[model samples]
Target chain A: MIDESRRVSMDIHYEISQHYFKEATYLQNWKLREWLSEMVDEEILYWMPIEENRLVKDRRPEPTPDDAAVYNDRYKHLKQRVEQIYTGQVWVEDPRSKIRYYVSNIEAFHTDVENEFAIRCNVLVLRHRRDTQIYQHSFLKEDLLRKTKAGFKVVRRKLTIDARSVQDKNLFFFM
Target chain B: MSDKDVAFISGAVRMYRERRGWYRSVCNVFMVGEKSRMEMRVMINVKELVDLENATQAKKIFWDQDIYDQEQERIFGRSWLFLTHDSLIPKNGDFVMSRMGEDKVIVSRQKDGSVEAFINSCSHRGNQVCHADSGNAKAFTCNYHGWVFGQNGDLVDVPLDTLCYHDNLKKAELGLRKVRVESYKGLIFGNMDPDAISLEEYLGDMCWFLDTILVGAGGGMELMGPPLRSVLDCNWKVPAENFVGDGYHVGWTHAAALQILGGPLAGLAGNRADMPYDDLGKQFTTRHGHGFGAINDAVTSIHPENEEYADFMAETRGVVAENLGTPREELYMSHWNCTIFPNCSFLYGTNTFKIWHPIGPGKIEVWTYTLVHKDLDIDVKRSIQRQAIRTFGTAGTLESDDGENMSTCTDSNRGFVTRKGRMNSTMGINREGRHPDFPGIVGASFIGETSYRGFYRFWAEIMDAPDWEAIKVQNDNWDEIWRGSEFWSDK
Candidate 1:
């Protein structure tokens, strides 16, 4: 607990949080292509898995990355989704819903991997669609950021939502 | 009322629900123990609700609680409902939670590789004995009070049984309610009715059509699961009928996505005036409500971007032709939208399988699985899974387009006045008949509602029939309802 060497300094914390803030803006503005190009590595694994409440004996805290997910995507597929959304024809997103992502409780830690840091943050996503309940859910996301010539790029991102089953109509946006 | 009178009253409730939009408030009013009085108000003639001859269906069927209730008891209780696939629970003690109509059931693979299913509710207190969506379990122990049931739904143990009950407890008699289980080509189905016909008999001629897709390239298909489940506000029948034979919507509803994606189906975008409407494909319906519309040479339409999948299909067509026949070989190279009676549907080209589990009159839980040939390369299977998820998964592009329409179809009928209207399914009714090569009544065009007539024809039959015996009595005369001049007779 008292390892000062491992603890990230306030300067580094600000840097990481600021980068996260910018990414959130791109998503909120529906500039997903721009966000992906600027912040994500070409070989990144962006995943958000479905959660099930199983019995204690069958419970595993972390399901493998290869397990079934709502979104287990790579660069090409993600780019297609982004392009489709921009077409103003994907009905679910044509009249895009208003989404605001609150990314906070940021923590940055130094990992043993070379030039890589783990960023854990609590993201509260508030989404509003036509004449429906405001879908608000909190999820914890862990992203591994690697230092690049252009500041940083997410090499891996894993999101675990805190809901038994998704009740919303559609998840048309990235979390 | 007498038992017969109660049954008739229940049927009357369904007729009223189909003739007048019976929303939740209407259900709440009658659910307050005034069913006898409500039955008097809802004594509608069933013949008027579904005019099979005229191909008109009352709108109330979509959002009426009474009709939903009747469907659960009569249709679901009697029909062979899809439970789970063999690949999903392959090993002993492996179980997956599934639904039979509204009732929750657990499908478990026993040690002998035979499958068994039982209601998920505990016999003691009606609490769900198994809460997990899926997992391997030696036995499911009830979390509420520690009542343990074995893999085959046999009650194995009870805490304080001897001391609390003085050994009077009959554990054997208190097992979870069992269902009649059967499998056809690795697909397991369950029925609550002991007197219902067997699964093979229930599928009837639909099997000939199903064989083209389910059994392919020498190995059968497998469902890639833990299925993506999500709730939507829509009547279960809306999607069921759409999948059965609503090819008309594809060119318009998903026009934008199709154009943007740009595949073999892109010409359908914007409902282009000059598109090949007549030569698109064919539709079929069998003795059961099972039906499908197929488009020739567009098997991989949505994923036109995928070349490897196309190569796999091209390489395997000859083997399929050898194994099944030329008729099936033609089917193998086509895109299809199919529905198996009550609520299982899949697309052959799109390769997305779905179960629309009705939660209420106006809501359903959609469980989606990607279907793939078992013998394909793992990479090809993965690619198909990816494309399937992209097109029809919970948040898929094409799926979302239909979601809004399905919801509106149900909710808009909430007005009592709106339920009095009729929804037309008379698109190609007069142009379909028995085909020489195909087993069911075939339509000339894919973009027609011929299958809708067949779907509702059986829906009304099951809704009115008391048991499988009654269904069998009318089986010989089933095609008599579709009395069109045989269009395919010359072909």
Candidate 2:
């Protein structure tokens, strides 16, 4: 028989994993603004690839006192980008509209502090546009998850693409 | 044999020469006029190009086959094409695949620590010798015919040579053709011409500009690879010209991106008049056609939110000033949209280096690498690479926008009639001249077409000159076209 303490620990772990999984799904689904406001801390460091030794970093914009307005503004910008697919606002996405994303191979590791876990996963995205042409692309993402009072949230995320040349029509789909 | 008859003959010859010159000039003007109409009526000719002096209007140069073939011989063959950075092949036997025009070439570091490059095709059957993009190997063996070649381009052995030829075939004569290779600081370049000018002399005053980013702050730059490669259906010169000095596009083309990022450059999104347009920055074109459009005091435009990055640039500014002097020091702190003539471009402050590897008149395989200071911390390096990929890589936000424009520009010039018409690049025509502090002719603003003119001037020289010897006669006359002007003296 499972003890009460053990049951509680298992419940917490499951809850954290479920939340983290959902957050990752949201990000892959092009819901960054929602995910950002929901999980990310005030100061989140986003590291991206430059060529040689260079790195391009983007920190989350500071939140305003009018939280709804700020969230709405951010959401509108994201929506505009998403809406670009139909309106030709973003040319990269107009020609290629079909995308198939496979998010799997999830592994969770404990961080230095208790109640904090790091999640690493492999994502294989196959995109097709105009017709039935297969274009395979993949990326590896590492996420830091902290157990919050509301369950779990992402603290930081690092993404590394496999291909040296980004072999795609354009970067329309979020990785 | 009378003196009068002698004078008449001389006069007749002079008249004949003058008439020939006039006829050529008229034909050029007519071609330019026809090209301009073509740009408006149909797709501009992507490949067919006329003489620059004949081109009264800016003509699309991206889709012409004859022009592409000419470029392969006149420009790519003779010019010192950038191969790879030395950091990529630090150890002996290290090799990387690079492109010259449409041809593939392998650049390898020899056992003697010297670098060499050769056409990637096998000599026997014209099959590609090295299949992998990069690796460390003492020798490369052809997969098709089983021929082996040393790293320095010597034919080491062949499987059936002795058996088929009975020791009669010449092994030394079958080696791969070697290209002339040279490097400035850590950047390597390859040339196909045996009689081409030395790389340093070819680079000319552009070296001074290069030193600002290459050797500034007592810190040298290194390229982070493997490169991010992508194909864009556009004329290679479009991007080359854009990066060389078209800062005008940033505030307009990337308005949405800038609005979303909301940094130092966000104010440029709505075309705000109070954004200090006049004093924003200056544009420069060099003798060798290297040029840049800079945005003053906004080096970290892409990442204004990163305090650590801003601090790093600030810390390095003092060192750059001490090493390269004040003018270049100012350049170090500014965001530069720049291009090295023929087809290498980069954002100096943004730290993204790119080579618009031309595939044909209308197609280009863009190879992008992140540029960084060698002395920076590992974490910082990783961060820079990540951001570079995010913003400029194949899927980069900014890269995607530019790709569509490049493709449209190249594709629209496919019509025959369209190819004949000229497009306008006459912006700041009578306004640009020499300045006391700047090297090349200084245009009035960063958005002007002065550098474009400079590029076309060199392009014409290479296209028309029969040989290197022919090109030598125009070396001293380079500045003659811009003389007798004082437009930039006060500025």
Candidate 3:
């Protein structure tokens, strides 16, 4: 008997980790179309909200999808973004930024829904571009995944980047 | 008399004098440069560097540290920098960390709803006093010596004053150096130089244009923050100039994104020759280096899905027409890429506000915010914000598309010979001139580099002028160069 809100079994945790790794692999290899089709749910809400630096004592509510966010994207929005990559006129990626994604500390918890699992993980991505410049991004990613007939699908993914100010030119690559 | 305590009074005066003298030196040092006034005047002949005749800028401006440093002294020092908006800090004690050139600043809203700013440095020892990006606080306490400053930046408390300094610390004189702040509509701006003109006057004729969006509808606009911040390897001016008036790059630089983007302007993918070279829209350049290039009737064009914004804009267009007039009504419907001299830029239609804070000559910290109408439906505002970031935020499709070009544009100048070369912006130079309806020097088409030259023209003036007084002298004849073309009279 799986209690809702309880941590999932080790087998379920391993299963979610494998699923996350595949999503990371699809992102790393520039297989965005496949990533979306195979790993993402049609009603997915991919979000990355603008987080302010506030004092520990300050209790203002955190930003929601209603506020300014880097990626408050729906399935259609994500599809459109992914479509631009395959357009071939994308000159910036022609030389191809060498990117490696590391997903770790993944934990799975049972959600209210029978097949759905609430997941949390840490993602560290390193990107090397042109000749010398390199960029690093660390994120605390909160995700909701569901076990479907076709395997696993990401229902939601909210990424909180660690750095207050991004050191890179842009966060173009998937995390 | 004998009761005067002569030694104590004299010692205090001497100490006060000593403190005053040290502060004067700190002011000169901290303000970037006042001691080396002549060096600023003769260091670089900006007229030579920014050639009005050629519409070319020296590549050195993008790569040289000396040129960049001079800009911090003249351009950033003299300029009215964008601070925060009223909507973001609705409550008192709300604050945000900002920058003026390289100097760190703390912008705070007081209990009286008045906004104030500071240099963010401690009065003693120069250690950073306020560390967080923003928060509610009664006072800021220095980590070093526990020196406490009030919400208005007045020094109020210090650690063990009697035990430490015999109770003689001058708290009144040692408050965090205040900056001159003024708000235009709901948008707040801070100036370092007290002698500089008011923010409204500094905006010049751009204020006339800004009012279309800022006040055309009933409630005007408010910015959503904290902003999307990222560092880009490019001169602050590069993006500033681009947004000021580089409509030419939209089709080419964002070709990939546009090919797939099903929008009104998607026909512009790859800068097609058939798109009417001179009929696209108009570019306007006002005094004080502020400028914009307007693309015709494409408000909310980027947000293809949210026709709610388009519908809301259509509804507001009538109100704007009634309140402001026909020109502004038409402006209300149009999309614009604009910059307020130096480094603040925004795309009106896209509603993406940006502050390009310079890190060095070839690098900048790009702070991005979403500007929304105060009266728009909450859903519409949310949709607009999403679309704004999707195209212009840190990982924006279009924004992602252009970062490489901006980086490479500055990177090429790293070479010795390359740094000495000239880069041309001479597109549609003859097509622009004065206009009857508009107050500024208006160009024939949006794609022209007419505004680019105008931007550089004022840039050179500000960089070379010794002070605001010197700049004020040339104000009457500032647009004399563009007036030579005489396009409006012929039209």
lDDT, each prediction: 0.84, 0.71, 0.86
**Model 1, DockQ value?**
0.51
- lDDT per residue for candidate 2 within B325-355, as digits (tens), equals 8888888888888888889889976778999
Ranking by lDDT: 3, 1, 2
Please give the range of 10 consecutive residues that has the lowest summed lDDT in model 3 chain B.
Answer: B34-43
Q: Pick the candidate with the highest DockQ.
A: 3
Q: Which RMSD does model 1 reach against the true structure? A: 5.5
User: Which regions of candidate 3 fall more than 4 Å away from where they truly are?
Assistant: A1-5, B1-42
lDDT of 1: 0.84
Top-TM-score structure, candidate number: 3
The alpha-carbon deviation from the true structure for residue B213 of candidate 3, after best TM-score superposition, in angstroms, is 1.3
What is the lDDT, from 0 to 100, of the residue B402 in candidate 3? Answer: 73
Residue B55 in model 3: lDDT: 90
Candidate 3: tens digits of C-alpha lDDT, residues B134-158: 7788789989988998888889998
Error of 3 at A131 (Å): 1.5
